[model samples]
Structure formats: C-alpha cells, structure tokens
Target: MTTMKVTERVQGMGGPGRGGPFGSSMVGQKSMTFGPSAKRLFARLAPERVKVLAVLALAVASVALMSIAPKLLGTATDLIFEGLFGKQLPAGVSKEEAVERLRAAGDDRVADMLSSMNVLPGQGVDFGAVGTVLTVVLVLYVGSAVLGLTQGLLLNGVVQRTMLRMRAEVEDKIHRLPLSYFDKQPRGELLSRVTNDIDNVSQVLQQTMSQLLTSLLTVVGVLAMMFWISPALALIAIVTIPLTIAVTGAIMKRSQKQFIAQWRATGKLNAHVEEAFTGHALTKVFGRRREVERQFADQNEELFKAGFGAQFASGLIMPTMMFLGNLTYVVIAVVGGLRVASGTMSLGDVQAFIQYSRQFTQPLTQVASMVNLLQSGVASAERVFELLDASEEPADAPGSAASVSRGRVEFSHVSFRYEPEKPLIEDLSLVAEPGQTVAIVGPTGAGKTTLVNLIMRFYDLDSGHITLDGVDVSSMPRRSLRGQVGMVLQDTWLFHGTIRDNIAYGRPTASEEEILAAARATFVDRFVHSLPDGYDTVIDEEGSNVSAGEKQLITIARAFLSNPALLILDEATSSVDTRTELLVQQAMAALRSDRTSFVIAHRLSTIRDADLILVMEDGRIVEQGSHHGLLAAGGAYAALYQAQFAGPVVEEESLV
Candidate 1:
C-alpha cells in the first residue's frame, strides 16, 4: 500500500501545464527512509572517489588550521598581558595608577585580570612580538580560505560529471521499459524524474555535500580545542547539545509530514497543468476550462498549506538554536570569570574557551538547518532511482534469431488481455497469405488494432504463437521482426526536422534520389514544392505548422522509404480530404501490390476491394469473405454495410 501511494504520487508529479523546478516543492516534502537510495547515490560518486577523498582531506586540514588559530590568538593575548605587568611597569607608579591605566587602555575585565599578576616597575611592552603573532594569525586564515576554494573547484567537476552519468542511465532505462509501463504513467511525471528530479539532486550535491563535511569537521575540531582548554567550561557548552537536538527533532517531526504532503501536492498540481495545457483546445471546446481552473486552484491551495507548514517548522530551528547558544555562552562566561579571578584559568584561556564555544555550536546549528536540503535531495534521488528500477520489457531469447524471407503471417489461437481478469482478445485465430491485402473492420473496442499489435509483436500473446513465413515470430529478434514490417498509424508522428530528414528517419542511409522518389510516390512532393525551403523546410513539434493531411503524407513517405515486405495501415487516409484520400488509397494499393498488408478502416467503402474482408464483433470474426459475399450472407457485415448505405429502418427490414 505504501509503495502504491509513493508510486502514484511520484508518477503524478508535474501536472500538465504548470511545470516548475524541484525547489518549489523541496521545503514541502517529508523526510523518508533514504538510507538505501542515498547509498546508491554515493555509489554513483564512486568513480570520482579520488577527488571526493581529496576534498574531504582539504576540509579536515582547513578546519584543523582554523581551529588552532583561536588558541594561537589566545597565546598572543597572554603574551601581551605579560608585557603589561610581568615584573616590569612604569617608574613610580602606584598600584591604583597601574590598574587605572590598564583599565583605560583595554577592557576592565582584562585590567582586573592583569592587576592580579605582579609587575616590576619600568617594564616596557614587547610590541614586536604582538605584531608577529597577528601576522601568523592572518596567514592561517588566508591558507584556510585558499584550501576551501580549491576544494570547491574540484567538487564542481565531480558533481556535474556524476549527474551527467545519472541522466544517461535514466535515458537508457526509458528505452528498456515496456510500452505498458508508459501506458500507465503520465508523460509529464516521467519527464519530471529526468529533468526536475535529477536537477534537484545535482543542486544538493553541489551546495550541501561540501558544507556538510566541513561543518562536521569544524564541530569536531572546535570541541577538541574547547576540552583541551578547560573541560569544565566545555562541559557547560555540552549541555546545550542535547537540548538543541531535542528541539530540532521535535520540530522536524511535525514538519516532515507536511513536506511530504507539499511535494505530493506539487506533483498533482503539475500533472493537472500539463494535462490542461496539452489538451487546451479540447478542454475549451468541451467547456471544461472552468473545471480545469478549479482543479488547479484546489491543488495549488493544498501545496500552499503544505509549504507553509514545512517552512514554518524548519524556520524555527535557527532562532531557537541561536537563543540556546547565547544562553550557553552566558553561563560559560560567568563560570570562566570566577575561575579566572581565582587564578584557576588565565584571562587568555577564558577568551579562547568562549570563542571555541561559539565555533562548536555554530556548525551544529548549520547542520541542523541543512536537514531540509538533505531531505529534499534524498526525495529527488529516490524518485529518479524508482524510475530506473521499474520493470523492463522481457529480453529476447539468445540464439532465437530468424529471418522473414516471406511475409506469410498467421495467428494461431492467440489469447491475451491488458488486465488478467478482463479478457479482450480470446482464442483468436487468423491467417494472411503471403502478399495478401487483409482488411479488418470493427466498431470501437472490437480489438481491430490489438490484432495488428499482436502481429507486430508489440504485445506478446498469453497462449499460442504468431508466425511470419511459417516460422514462430518469437524466434526472431524484435528489431529484425519490426524491420520487415512498416507501419503508418492514424496519429501521425513527425519530429522537429527537415521534410527530407523526416522522410529518411526510418532509413538514415537512404540516398537523396530514393528520398525524393518516396516523397513523389506519396504525393508529399505536391506540398513540399510549395514551401519556402522546399525539402529543407523544418517541421515544428507535432507538425503543427503543416495541415493534418500534409503531416500524414510525410509519415506515408517515411514508410515508403523503408520499403518493408509487410505494412500495417491503421486509418492511414482518415486525415486526408476525399480527393486526396482517393489519391492516397491508389498509392497504398500500389504499395501493397507485392507485400502482405493489414488495413484497419471504419469506412466500409474503402476496404470493398480487399482480397479478404474480416468483419469483427466482440473480439471475434463474425463473417469473412469478399465485400459482395458478406452482403449476400446478410450477417454482421451485411447489416453494418446496409446501415451505412441505406437507412437503419431499411437495413432492419432487409435483415428481417
């Protein structure tokens, strides 16, 4: 049940029209058990293991250097204080005058600390030593910054290359997936996995991976310094750690669920927008524009609520951490001041402890703040990996290859269904003699297309076998089988390319003469000559720039270029006008003259000349003969033809 919900939500992301970047939903997704998925992601980074390890080493070195600086600065402070009162002071100076002078020159706290130390009169300050310590401190900070920059540059290449490889894997996965998988998924949602989800993973790796490592190192290094200076003060700072954890854990618990809801809502909204935009004309024509808008508004409002809850919860982490940190700092100061006054700790030691306290807690707070980013990255990775792990089309058997020397196709007792319990095609048997024009006519849902799909091996049968030239088609590789068959679907598909390129799509090695000849044979040359660029004219997406008839002609030309031994025409001429349809039919008749062909048509008049007409009803052939022979029998085909040619009443009278 959980898997189903996750799959549905992920598959439903990025509604039809209002697509967006993954960041829009990042704050709203719930944290999940990304342990396995995250491990997989790290495995992807393994190829760049050397660079990654180098970056980690730099981060550790940088943190160690920076951590030591505060301690070094403290030593300088102790040296300067020693210069002030180390058995050497101004001549004839009373104790009160020295204390007042120290106060005027520096902090009162430092003055009191200095006054406690005995000083000899006429001692001068060592300004040169102070200058040396300050210069070393500057050098350490500069070196740390340089290491950070070098790590950043190397990390950028590692991240981009990893993401590139991941995207390539996903593209390959798409090709291996079954057509049925796509049939159950939305195109927009799948596109989101490839585009938005992969991009989010990239962002997280680029932005967070280094910070997470460096922050952790800083926290560890600073804590070591704190304990090394004064365990008592370090203990005081440690008290805030559990409290910070408890508070952040509680808040994240509340917000995590909201984030999940937020991302799911975003996906739903995107899916709706994608659907509405893709079918905008149909929606408007059906007066469904208002309904679509209402659905979108509802999904958007849900996202707003989820986003609000998530952001509000995560927003509380930083300020709460800061407040608790400040409170810890105050406690550390009071205790350290008492210890310093009693000479248990030096003024310089007290100052170093305070700095270390801030440094330790700062990285803790930063890591806490990164929880949302980490969660978003994991969620996106899970979505992408989920697609990669989906079921793929069954592989063809090894050494089962065969060649189609003849196009004699036959289906022997084929049985299949899209769903197991609901059978659509049952115990179907048929034959198409070599070079025969077999016309299959059926009403909607009568399995006309499904029959051809079986013959083309698009869907494997549950029982029996399909054969080409008396050999089982299952013995041949899919590519080899499809290579011998040419198809022109009712819905024409033309990519954004030149007219000549579109025609040569199936056979890229086709010569210019062959392409021009195919175009001429399909009557595509009629319109090609009228275009501004002629054969070089580029077609837009969906071929929207050209008329439907012209687009169909291009597809027909593509099929002609392939010149296969068998053809499947599914309502091939339905897009053309009467005159053009006649011309296309003539061309198809000539094309099928020597090749076995399957023509599925609704227009009874079109298939009257078929060598054999198979009239179908409810997934079975109710009658089979010539067009005249079926009419003479007065069965299902005769009734259908009569209803179309004569009035329904007259057809009923003739049937009775």
Candidate 2:
C-alpha cells in the first residue's frame, strides 16, 4: 500500500502522527522498565484474557492484511509500467538484449511470468488486473479498520470495568485496614493512589495496550514480508535495530529514575494541597500562609524537575530512531536501485521494500516507546496493590454472639501502647455499672482518650481484656460492638448533608418525630429553624456554614438518636455557650440516667456532678471519687478545679 493509504488505515491504531519524529507513543510515555508489579497486574488481567486474546487476534489479522497490500500494490506497479513501456524497446533489438532490458525493468519472477503470457508488444496494459488489485487493497483496508475499531470498543469496556472493580476493591480495602494504617499515612497520599495512580493505569489499558500489541505484530509481519522479498535488503534494514536499542538504553537509564521521582513529587504535592486547603482557615489564623506556600512551591519545583528530566530523556528516542530509520532508508534506496538495474529486482519491488522498511521501523519505535507507558502503568499498579495487601483489622471471633444487655463496661488490667518502645497505658482497670455516670479527667496525653478507645474497641489492648457486659469486646464483630456504643468526639464531623440527615446519620430509620425529638434534646433545634431551609439546609463539607458549637450539637443529636447501651461524650459540649451548655447538661443527665456513660472533659465544671470521677496524670489514674469527695480530699481533681476557678491562664496551664 502507499504510505498515504497505510497512514489512513492505522490512524486509530496509534501509528506515528504527523510532524513528530516518534509520535505521541514515545513522547507521552513516562518510564521504560516494567518491574515485578507487572506480573501481578497481568495476573489481575488474566480473567479477561479471552477478550485480550481476541484483541491480539484482531491486531494480527489487521497487520497481516495491511502487510499483503504493499506487495500486491508493488506487483500492480510493475504490470502497469511494463505494459506501457515494453513495446518501446529500441528497434531491431536482439532477443537476448530484449530479455535483459525486460529483466532490468522488473523482477525475474514478474518478467518471466509476463513474457510467458505475452499478448503482443503493442497490446495495452490489463486495466482489469489493476482494478482487481485496487479493489482487494480497498477491502483489506476497510476490514483492518473495522477490526481495529471493534478491538478498541471491546478493550474500552474491559478497561473501564477493570478500573471500576479496582477502585471498589481499594475502597473496601480502606475500610478493612486497621485505624493504625491511616494513622501513619497522609490522607492525600492514599487519595492519590486511588485516583491519580489508578487513572494512569486506566489510560495505559485504554490507549496503550492495543497499540503495543498491534505494533509488535506489525513489526513481525513486516520482517517476514521483507525477508520474503529480499533477505539482503531486509538485513540492511535490521541493522538499525541495535542502534535504536543503544540510544534508548542510554537515555532511559537516566529517565526511569526521574519518572519515579516525578510520581513521588506528585503525591507530595497532592498531600500539601490537601492539608493546605483543609486547614486554610487555621493557616490564615496562624499567619502561616507564607510557610505553606513555600512548602508547596518546593514540591512543585521538584515535580517540574523530575517531570522535565523524564520527558526530555524519553523524547530523544523518537527523533534518534527516526534519524536512524532515514539512514536505513537511504541505504536501501541505493542498494535496491543497483539491484534493479542489474536485472535481479524490479522498480516496484524497490518501492515496496522502501515502504516495508518504514512500516517495520515504525513499530519498533512504537514498541520502544510503549516500554515507558507499560512501566508507568506497572508502577501505579504497585501502589494500588500496596493498599489492597495492607494488614486488615483482625477478624472477630467466630460464633461469638452480640449480646450486651446492661451497659456495664470494664477495662481489666489493660496494658497498651501505640508503639512498642513506649507504653501509654499500663495495668489500667476500671468499671462502670449500668446507669452510672463515670467522668474521666486527665492532662493531655495522659491516656484518658486511649482508655476510651479501648472501651470502644477502636484499638485492641496490647495485653489485656476489655469487656462489655462481661463479654470480651474483641470477640464480637467490630460493627456489632460499635453499634451498641455511641461516641461524640471533640472533632465533630458532619458530612455534606442536611442538618436533619446529619442527626439521623447513626439511625437512618429514625422517624421525623424521633429526629426532631433528638435534635430538640441536644438543642440542635434551637438554631436549625432560624435558617432559611430549616432542617434541610445543605451543610458544606466540614460544616463551614455552621458554627463549631452547632456542629457539636448536631453530632450530639446523632449519638442521642442511636440510643446506645454505652455513651461517650469527649468534650462534647466544650464549644457551647453557658446557656446551651446547661441545656446540654440537662440532656446529658437524662441520657446518662439509664445508660452507662464515660465523660472526658478538660473543663472542670462539666463533670462535677458525676457519680464517679477519675483524675489521670501520665497515663495512670491518680485519684478517683465523687465530685465532692475528690474536692474534700484535696486531690488532683480539687487542684484542677481550683486552677480553673482561680484564673484562665492557670486553667490553661493546668488542664489539657
């Protein structure tokens, strides 16, 4: 086929584009080395092997058909040339001279075949044969295009479905992972893996996978056809392969490291953006905007350097390969012309060989470029699998029933540490009988929150048993145990939803009346009605439209709706004004009257009326008694109370 015809047929097949020495295949690729991660990726793709095989089959057929067109067009060229010029041989030419002249104009095969079927020196060329060849070329081109489009459509489905499942798996894996997994990782980094990295993998599957396969097949088909036509010329064309490899090897060795650095910098940049944006208000309040911007600029500069290095290196492959290919083309032209003049090859064969040479080298260039895309794809896959393979939360004990009747909770000799080197909680034991209010007060980092976490089974104790109603909390499914316990933390989280929806989050089936009752109990109903949308107003992410105290009340309403056997209020009302605090205190008193409650507070005034109070310092409880009893004893609780009442500075310094 002519270069124009071939170009049109392979346009969608990711053939070299116009004006670019290497085309997008090479330029857009990231790295050039597939690592062990590729094996796992292939294994994951194995289930779709039948579809992939079909794509390969279509690619092979398409390349094969296109390959045959060039040779056929060459034959047609010779037939027309000979028919027009055969009769014009010099007058009185000897038979041997005539034969040599005919042989010089065409290949020995075509010359002998035409001579055997001669019509006469003056007979016109066979237009019908040329028309037939043209028709077959048209059909092949059409068939190849149809197959290519079909393959693209099929692969698109496969790729989208694969990414869908992969994303879902990652999301599920996130839930299964222990809370500790999130403790050490930046939320933005994990977000990058789930989004950006997976997107890269999807792009490779959708655009590069079929192209890589077709390019390989085209290279092989071209090689076979080249050898069939003339082994000598094919060998000359093949010489460029080693040169291409050498150029690629030298450039990619440096570029691969850059690709890795680029992606790492990308993740860091994303993390910085997430933090900066999430805490923009705090950053502004603290006058740290300049510092945050500096950090961001540093990350951006790193990404630019790494990205430029990678692109600059990979970009060299195309132009360098193109130059070598052109050099090969020149050699073929000189040698083929000599052979044609020597009566061994035809003019048409020389033309076809040149076209075949271009076709052959194009795939080599494409495949070389594909190496980078494949490696980048594999790298992204590795990040994704890292999450999928992370340690999951330990499974709950089998056959254990979820039966917590009374709200009694006990922490029995619970020794725990976040890290092995530093023990945070040691031999801590506590018990709250049903319907008793147990208030825990502590200095910052005194393991008060850690103690509550153990009771909620958020983290398993290092060496102790936390039981709910005499049943080991670890034995029950985490979901079931957590369902019976309600916690309202200081950092009130409200998703982007209506005020009513936020309150009803823990009990979705709660009726409108039930929701309103809980909201009223927590005083959430006080301001909600003053808003334009009433309870239906959409809360922005982080509840930016609402005050912190309002957000805290909404969360309290949520916990109240759950009506769990056990309740935890961790500075739940610290944001409210005195009036609202008294209202909340009344609500808390009523709620705590029938359920076990653990109240952790920095403000000494909130839990003074508790049935019991435990004062903690340095991960150990230093004092425990009723509010009056502790004050009378002049212990840690009394000292904390005195500091708070004495002065704000003293209170801030004395309490966490």
Which candidate should be chosen as best, given lDDT against the real structure? 1
**Candidate 2 pairs with clashing backbones:** 1-70, 31-372
Encode model 1's per-residue lDDT on 1-656: one tens digit a residue: 00000001111123222333221222122334655667888799999999999999888888988999998888778777766665455688766687788778866765676666544455655678778988998999999999988989989999999999999999999988866676565665667778878898899888888888888999889989999999888888889889988998887777766666665665666665666787888776888777777777877898899888888887788888988889988999899989887657887788888899889888878878887776667767877877887888778766656766668988887777766656666676778888889998877667787778877777788887889989887777788888888999888899999999999996899999999999988999998889999999999986877999999998998998998888999989889888988888888888888889999998887788898998877556777889999889999998888767887778788899
lDDT of each: 0.79, 0.78
Model 1, global lDDT:
0.79
Cα TM-score of candidate 1: 0.88
- TM-score: which candidate is best? 2
Q: Which runs in model 1 stand beyond 4 Å of their true positions?
A: 1-32, 86-121, 647-656
For each candidate, give its TM-score against the true structure: 0.88, 0.89
Can you tell me which runs of candidate 2 are displaced by over 4 Å? 1-33, 90-97, 100-120, 648-656
